[model samples]
Target: MDPYRRLVRPALFRLDPERTHEAAIALAERVGRRLPRAQIDPALEVTAMGLRFPSPIGLAAGFDKGARAVDAWAAVGFGFAEVGTVTPEPQAGNPRPRMFRLGSDHALINRLGFNNPGSVVVASRLAAARARGRVAIPIGVNVGKSRDTLAERAVHDYAAAVERLWPYADYVVVNVSSPNTPGLRDLQARSALGEILTAVLDVDVRSAEWSGEPRRPVLVKLAPDLSDEQVDAVTELALELELAGVVVSNTTLSRAGLRSPAAMTSEEGGLSGAPLRLRSTELVGRVARRAEGALAVVGVGGVSSARDAWDKLAAGASLVQLYTALVYEGPSLVRRINRELARMMRERGIERVADIRSAG
Candidate 1:
């Protein structure tokens, strides 16, 4: 482990999780430009969802809520960055003290409730990034329903956000996961998910025509708490809809194996980070096995080290993403994880990252 894992992250963790996150973004924006281009081994490059990623390591959504720090994160060596779980209308999300750090478990529980500046503001920032040519790799926009959006009108809510942000995003994700959103996860029911995906993809096709570019790829993010039956249904829907892929297993509401104190345990929200590694990995593997190459799987949750990432890959993740680990491990963790991943790939005599998509 890097010395910062022991030294720097501990200090950062002492601060409130949300405040430290903002501070980290500010710092990255200041110094990210100076960081050299990440030296990723060619073997690590993989194209998925119609975009080329320098490596499999990506920053998951909910980290950059407003698409405000794309260049900063890209400079830090993430192969791809997903921003926002933006809603149709701007929202303050849950009240303060919504994010809590469980350092002992390398986990975090947050009820931020998609606190973002809404799709319009995020679209403007992304447009600016594109105009400035600041984005180095594919950037995905994850869209969700507004808290006030009724369940019956979910399609309209999602379509509105998709139409607004589609031009700026290399790909779009229909985030029906996120445990913090009431009635959100219910949308993952096969019938509900199908309607949402169909509506979003329809918008994507029209948006592409308007921009004179190929249709942007669309994927759905699922909750980790799903049953195998739900996973199977979602996998079928993906194939039926001809979606680009699936983002297996978002943060879980389940608090199993959390080693943090009882006070920390009392906080409500989805749990992510180290404590989630095993269950998330298992879910990824199951999805991969079930999907059977029908659609790509972007494995996320609890990926802290190269070994954890490799395990996810072996279990069937075409790409891997992390958010909570970055909180506990520091910015340098991205490069370190990629480098070690390359080494591990070499040790395994693998030529391409996708070659191990189901090594398990």
Candidate 2:
């Protein structure tokens, strides 16, 4: 283990997970500004969704909830960065102590409920990042429903957010997967998902016309707990709408395979990290096989090492993302994973990262 894991992470882990997250983000922003850029090989760059990515590895949404740390994360060797789960309106989210660390399971349980400074604030930050040239890679913004919003009005809320942030985001993710948000996951149903996506895509079309650029890619992030039938239904919807892609999963509510004691496991929230690896990977593989080149697949969940990333790629992920691993392995995790992935690629005589998109 690195010195930080042995010494620093343990200390940080002792604090409330949410507070520790804020502190870590603050430290990364402060320290990242002073650090020199790490060198990355040209072969690592790949293009997808009409945008170029320096690497296939991206920092997932929910890490920089309000687009507050894009520059810092981008500077740390991320191919791209996704911000938010931003709602149409700002929200305080669930009560305190909503985030828990399961060190033994290499996992996290968060009921953050898409707490953010709202789409307006996030858009302003993104606009500033663009002007400052601090956001080079494709930046995707994840939008979710407001906690107070009723399910019947979810489309209006989502549409409003997309209209505000579409100009700044390289792509927009309609998030209806987080289990913590009451009735949020219900939006995954075929009819509900279709309506939500239609509203968001309409905004994409309008933004394209106004800017004279192609319509930005719009994707949906799904939860891992869905049945295969549900996955197929969502895939069908994605294909029907000509959607850009699907983020294979958000955190899962299931607590299976947890090494943590039963008492800790009983804590309410979505579970992310190692325990989710197999299931999320399997879901990605299934989606990739089903989508069959019609849509993009962004694989996330339980990815902590290069091998884990490779599994997701081989299974059919055009791109891969990580969040919880950064909490466990530190900022250098991106650099380390990319290096190892490149080495694996070279070992396999692969010329491009996308070459292995369907290896499994």
Candidate 3:
């Protein structure tokens, strides 16, 4: 019997979603050090954006918003972990009762609004962890514009965050796709995105010069609601800017096919989980075809199983991430997915994750 589904999940489901998340993070932080490290199969290892990933499955950004328990995330089986939708300055996010669970639909809707401890605090925590040699896997920091920052200053906001976080990050993500922040998604437009990426790249260059470390790779996270033409434009711009990758997608505003209750489904926020699986996969394939190996694609949206992860890889995703699935499936799902993925690869006579695209 799965203890998480039978015992832990029931108790967790009883609490308010935000509170439950807080408790889970606290517990992981305390127990992380004592947890046994996961033994990942060599066949499941991957190298993307010049960083080695022990497994393709990674804990996506939203779950570890404050950079908490990254080591624990790895201990459980994730190959990498991306933390934050952090801002240059901290702000209290939207009002409470923000996160909603649609158990039947296997989805979650949140308007958390880039609520984080800001770059300074998060950077300090990561620095402390690095000093102790606790971060064993690659840690990517996803940065967003501060809510109060004006549209014109958005580039400055993103650049400031990268300047502060570069030393501690394996890669930095420019999050212009989150629908929670009012004008956030507008930054995804090609001209706007180009300006932001240029400024962010400039920050990376300066940070690398100052720290004597190689420039940290930068990626952009896009929305799942974009038109095919819009997606192509962004992919072309990303290539021109020389970005390391694109995280295909943040969350969506669409409530199109949800099976959850009206009150829950009616919530105004970004939707994720099973409801988003197909569209995000489609976007991943679209972006992959557009990128043509020039930019890596980090497929994330509704991934919950080995088959889901494999599908993303087959669609040309270099890596895969999940958050809502972890909410439903528990930590053990990570190892299970990796184990199944390795078995699938062996069955197909495929040896490398990169070859999944051509296996057919």
Candidate with maximal TM-score: 3
Better of 1 and 2 by TM-score: 2
Comparing 1 with 3 on TM-score, the higher-scoring candidate is 3
- Kindly list the per-residue Cα lDDT of model 3 for residues 237-333, writing each as its tens digit: 9999899999998899999987878988999999999889999999999999988999999999899999999989999999999999999999899
Residue 347 CA displacement from its true place in model 1, Å: 1.6
Report the C-alpha lDDT of model 1 over 1-360, residue by residue, as the tens digit: 778777887787678878988887787766765665677777789988778999999999999988878877767779999999999889999889999988788888999999999989999989987897768888999999998888999999899999999989998999999988899999999888889989999999888888799999899999989988888889888988889889977899898877788898889999998878888888888878877887789899899899999889999899999998888777788988988988887887888899876454
Cα-based lDDT at residue 23, candidate 1? 86
Top-down lDDT ranking: 3, 2, 1
Q: Which stretches of model 2 miss by more than 4 angstroms?
A: 33-36, 358-360
Clashing residue pairs in candidate 3, if any? none
**Could you tell me which 10 consecutive residues in candidate 1 have the lowest summed lDDT?**
28-37
Better of 1 and 3 by lDDT: 3
Each prediction's TM-score versus the true structure: 0.96, 0.97, 0.99
Candidate 2: the clashing residue pairs are none
